[model samples]
Target: MAEEVKLFGIWGSPFSRKVEIALKMKGVEYEYIEEELGNMSPLLLKYNPIHKKVPVLVHNGKPIAESVIIIEYIDETWKHNPILPQDPYERAVARFWAKFIDEKCLPALWNSTWSKGKDREAAIEEASQHLNTLENELKDKKFFGGEEIGLVDIVASFVGFWFGALQEVSGLELLTEEKVPKLCKWSYEFVNHSVIKENLPSRDKLVAYLSARFADASK
Candidate 1:
């Protein structure tokens, strides 16, 4: 029997959008359930009781949490437009970068935006160093997986879809082409790609959302 697929996520969440993009790349049909973060639904609560986070993937009544893990599950299950590399070593490298992006780059980017003065500068330098490392890894490739959007691409959604909006929100110039030309180009290409372009939240909307949060945090 063909399994049913359902995804619960909020509109402005890049992590949630990562799952959407992964499913699109794999050509998997799913019911997209928009969750209200302030008033999370019982279904989301039930499935992800531990984290109570969005981007929960439920396939054949089984639930998977976390965007990267869900994308990996989708890659394994669908098997058509694959995300990970076939060879063990390449897959390991992909996983390493994915985790690095998540653990190191993402936090540094967010902190750079959320902090002030010297702290912000330090965060920007840290984020830039991480991006430079990724830039060297990418070299001249169009995508992280060398011609295809893969796991690393999914995890790097912050760069693809939200960097500009976050820049507006934080009033910072972090991911400019002058700073990281190749990564900047990849971000534009990834955002405008046919597969997941329509799924993106409006840049203005994200700016508004994050700006409000910054204001509240500043007060």
Candidate 2:
């Protein structure tokens, strides 16, 4: 019998899309199940009881939750296209940046869009700092993984696609070419990469979606 692979995800979620991108990069054939995040399905709940989040990957009968974990699992399982560095130290560095992107940068970036007054200012400041950190790290590299897309590039995929969309919807500017030119350039390169371009949600649709959501949240 053939091994079964299924991914439960939402269309607009970067986290979910990142997993999909990884799958595509590895030439992994899997079923894509779109989920309505607002209405959680029992299957999703069963697969990920703790988070009840999208981007759950089920291989055979086993389930994996969280996009990062799922991505690493896919990398390990496929082994055709290496997502992380082979060198131990390089791999560790990649992991560190990936964690930073998820835990620190994304939160600040998101808050900068929705927050107001002092909080908004603070968020923008913190987000800028985080972006600068990335800018320095990516100074001369074609990709975060150096010559090719790797763990850090995959993890920071949101900044490439959603950053502009979120900024447009919120009428905020966190990532400007003038401010962080290198990172901005990286964003352009990453999103325009053949594989990533194919998997990206339409920018106009994303802006429209986020506009309504942010409008409601503000009220």
lDDT of each: 0.88, 0.91
lDDT of 1 by residue, 76-166 (tens): 9888988999999999999999999999989998888888889988998898788788888889999998888889988998877787788
Report residue 134 deviation for candidate 1 (angstroms). Answer: 1.7
Task: Please provide TM-scores, in order, for all candidate models, with all chains considered together.
Answer: 0.94, 0.98
Residue pairs whose backbone atoms clash in candidate 2: none
RMSD of each: 1.4, 0.9
For residues 1-219, could you state the per-residue lDDT of candidate 2 as single tens digits?
A: 998999999999999999999999999889999999789889999999999989899999899999889988998898888998888898889889999999999999999988899999999999999999999999799899998899899899888889889988888776899898999889989999999999989988888899889989989
Best by lDDT: 2
**Over the full model, what C-alpha lDDT does candidate 2 score relative to the true structure?**
0.91
Root-mean-square deviation of Cα positions for candidate 1 versus the true structure, in angstroms: 1.4
